[model samples]
Structure formats: C-alpha cells, structure tokens
Target: MTATIHSLPRKAEPSLEPLMTLVADGLNSVNTVILDRMQSRIPLIPALAGHLIAGGGKRLRPMLTLASAALLEYGGNRHHKLAATVEFIHTATLLHDDVVDGSDMRRGKKAANIIFGNPATVLVGDFLFTRAFELMVEDGSLKVLRILSNASSVISEGEVDQLTAQRQIETSEERYLSIINAKTAALFAAACRIAAVVAERPEADEMALDAYGRNLGIAFQLADDAIDYDSDAAEMGKDRGDDFREGKMTLPVILAYARGDAEERKFWEAAIIGHRTSDADLDHAIALIGRHDAVEATRERARHYAARAVDAIAHFPKSDAKAAMIEAAQFAVARRY
Candidate 1:
C-alpha cells in the first residue's frame, strides 16, 4: 500500500529559554544541590555521574518541578532540593537505560556505560538513585517520598514491560501506551504534583498539574518515537533508528505494522521479531514507515495529547508560569529533538 507523502510543516512552539529565564534563580539552586549531593568518597562515582549530568540536556524534568512550584507561588527553599532529586532520578534512569539498551550515545556523546564500563555505570546509577531518596528523606515529607518512590517503581515496571514487548510486532496500541504512561508520564506527573503538595495546595490543583505533566509526557515520548525514524543520529543526541535497532515496539513501528500488508508483515517479523535485520532492511523499514504515514500519524497523536495537556491546566489563573507550562506542553510535540 502506497501512502502519498504530504509534507507536514513544523509548528512553532515556545523555546524552553523563557521557562529557564523565569526559573533561573531556582534552577541555579537546584543545580547547586545536585552537585553537592552527587559527591562521593570514591572518585569514579562522581566522575562518571558528572560525565552524563554535565553533558547537558534540557533539564526539562527538573524545570517542571521548578515551574510547578513557582506557579503555586512557593517561597521555601525545599523545592530546590526536590527539583534536584527529580533530576537525579531522571539521570540515574538514563544511566541504567544506556546499560540495558546497550546504547553507545547519550546527549550527543559517548554513553557513560561505554566510557566508564557497564559495571561502573550501573553502580553509579545505583548511587545516584540512593542519593535521590536521601534528599527526599531530608525534606521530611512522607507525601513527597511516596509520590517519587512510586514513580520510580512504575518506571521500572514500564521498562520491564517494554523489554517484554521488544520486537513483538503484534504488540497492541493499548499495551504500548500503557508502557509509555508508566515509564514516561508517571514521573512527569509526580514531578509536577509534588510542587503543589509542597505548597499545600488543594487536591484539585495537584490533580490539574499532574494531568498537565502526564499528557505532556505522552506527547513528548510520541514525538521522540517519530523522530527516531525522521532524523539523523546526531540530531537526536543518539543513533537514529535506535528504537528499531533495539527491537523496541515504538509507535511508528506499531502503526506501520498495523497498517501494512501481509508481505510487509512478513518483513516486520524478520527484521524486528526474528532479529534478522540488515542495514538494507533498516532502509526498507524507513521507507515502509513513510509509505504508511506512520510518523505523521504519530505526530498527530502527539498533538492530541499536547492539546489535552493544555486543557488540563485551563482552570489555573493566567500568569507567566502558567503560560510557560502550557507552551512546554506544545513544545513536546513541536520540538524535533
């Protein structure tokens, strides 16, 4: 089946710059806490942790924590520690993920696992994970501990589910979404909701922020999945087709397989399920994805989620923080990287 390729123009969205500007002071505090907490008696631990943490990404997860706090007009220094904790959790997960995925790149450079070795990388990840919990305990908020700890468990479960579905072309959309929601959205929700909790906001406000972050997380992952097929390795800060190469059942692959003919199905089985893919087969897979409009479909799905994210926070009063949060949701789908 041939799908006519229609060019989809990129949508304009807010740069994270404005959000960074608004939260610059808070973010600085978060960074200071992150560095202080990452220190260890053993040199290799800090060295390896620094390699990934200092390598530089958007720091969006922690930024969400900061923004959510600011939106609630929080005045205490506690949110800084909480934001740092969120980043540590995120970074720790990335370290373990690189080892598990056998990935060679992260944030546009050699992965920590490759540089430090998998054993060292994994141990450092554990160290960071422990440090994150330490910070949570220092905050002395059982509610905060419960939310983040639960997110950590859900994230592990999501990764396991993804592992179980690896190369399984027959994986259903429901199953795929369940994995994304648990693996990706859960933390986003936790990060955002914790801000409201720290501020002692009403349950409704906490739920609204949670909804905003969860939907935005789903949109972010969907866009990332589409980008794997549409972009080059450098652009993505990792190898292109990493998902396909890893035999992960991302949305593009799922959508294409669902819409493909019997012959195409056989190709998916060999290239994905049977793990017999060659570089040439990867090229063909890209073609098949385009032919089925899988990337476009995935982008539209992301847009839908982004919209829902905006709606989730509709009741909040208009302010720079609120506007930035809404735009962050839009940027989830708008960003190419």
Candidate 2:
C-alpha cells in the first residue's frame, strides 16, 4: 500500500499592499494636492500641520476614496482633490483629538500640541479644516459638498458625545457604537461616498460604498481598542494605556466592566472615575480584561463588522479592486498595530 503525503493549506495573511498598489497613481495625485494645499504664507500653519501630516499615518481615508474610484472605473481626475479634502478633514480631526485627549504622543512622536503649544495646534487644525472646505468648493459638486460638510458636523457632535460620556461608567455599548459611528466612521463613509459622486454612480452604489467604509472604520477602531489592552501587542505609537488613564470607555472596558464581579466592578468604577490610574492600575485592568478574555471578545466584535464590510460590496463584480477591498477589511481585523 502506498500512502500519499498530505499537506495543510496555509492561511493567507491579509494585507493593504494590493489596495495601495491599485491606488498608487491616484494616491500620488492626492499626495501632491495634500502637500500643495497644506502650505500657507503663515509659516506656523504649514509647520504645525506638517508635523502631524508627515508623521507616519497610513492615509487610509484618502486611499479609500481612490480605491472606491478604482472600483467604479472612474476615469476622471476630480477625485484627486476630493481625496485630499478627505485627508485634510481627517488630519484636522486628529490634531483636535490629540488636544482634547491631552495626548503627549502621536504616531510614535510628541504630539503637535506638545511641540507647538495647544493654541497653535488648534489654529493649524482650523487651517486644515479651511483648506478642506476650499477643496470641497473647488470640486464644484453640491452633493459632495453636502456629504463632507455634514460628516464634519457629525464628527464634532460625536466628539462632544464622547466627552460627555467620559469617565461615566454607565456608558452602554449602544451609545459607544453611536459615538464611533459619527466620530470615526463618518469620514470613512464620506470618503468613499464622494468617489461614487465623482464617478456619477447611482445612489444605490454610493450607499453600498458608504456601508463598506462605515463598517470598515468601526472594525478598525475596535481593533485599535483591543490592541490598547492586548499584553502581547506591539507598540501602537500612541501612549499605551492612554485610554485607561483617560477613563475612556472603549468596548473592551465596557465588556470587562459588564462582566466583572462585584470586586472587579469596584476597581473598574474607581478606574473609570479617575481614582485608579497608576501603571499598576493599568496592569490590573489588563489582568481583569484577560481574566474575562475581553480583548479577544473585542477582536471578535471587530471580525463581525469586518465581515459586514466585506459583504457590503459583495454585489460588485469580481476585479482586483474588489478583491483588494475585501482584503483590506480582513486586514482591519488581523492588524495588531
């Protein structure tokens, strides 16, 4: 009797390389627009903005715009400036978020506010927002203008809602989702939706892309939340345990709190209310999270949204663009840093 050798199939690692390659040319144009539009006669405007912009961000939002255009086979250059606009809006939010969170580090370096002072950092963020609007008006589409502007407003509202919920241990999962949907996912949705507008695709197609971006954004944020507490995870650039110190009720914290026993609940209540915030407290917090397997639970939630994101674009015909997008969603869940 002859026995055949058996081999198991290796799991394919998800990656953004395909998406990046697919959008390379369009991304170059968007980068040019970003570099040009971020400049100003006032030295501080460009100086402060450049600090964060040149920082090692993945530029995922603008890339999403380019990828959406690729998926639609849009042959126009209109998306270049619009993609830059989405990036400006996103950068502005990051600057302002760092200030609001009192963050000292961002993207593996000192935050802009730390180097430039909060006032200058804030003004530069405003300048970026102004540049974003200028790009929007130059795009000459009322629908595009409305979508991005509304997203900007929604992001502000979400930030405010999150602030109100900060250190409030009673924050429910429903409310947390609502906050991220606006603060993070709104720009993601707008970024992709505008591509459909530029392509002149029908409303249904636009909605499909919007759903894809929104769910992907949520998945990405959830993964970030899990990384913050994952003991074996790589450095995330931002200060580790910043969320715990800030008393931000991320999903992992929410889940851990919800599942904690009476003793564990007391520790969480104190931690969220700003009582327990030492390095040891963070370690204990991580311990409690591990005891309940909350980080993995958070990752599971991310996988759910990532699957929804993939399904959102299922009706689109098979192409490199579609396959790249599906992999991007998979990457969102698989990424640790």
lDDT of 1 by residue, 169-248 (tens): 78998999999999999889999999999999999999999998898899899999999999998789998878888888
What TM-score would you give candidate 2 relative to the actual structure? 0.96
What does candidate 2 score in Cα RMSD to the true structure? 5.2
Clashes of 2: 0
lDDT of 2 by residue, 247-312 (tens): 999999999999999999999999999999999999999999999999999988888888778778
Model 1, position 25: C-alpha lDDT score: 93
Predict model 2's lDDT versus the native: 0.91
- The regions of model 2 sitting more than 4 angstroms off are 1-11, 231-234
| Cα lDDT listed for each candidate | 0.89, 0.91
lDDT of 1: 0.89
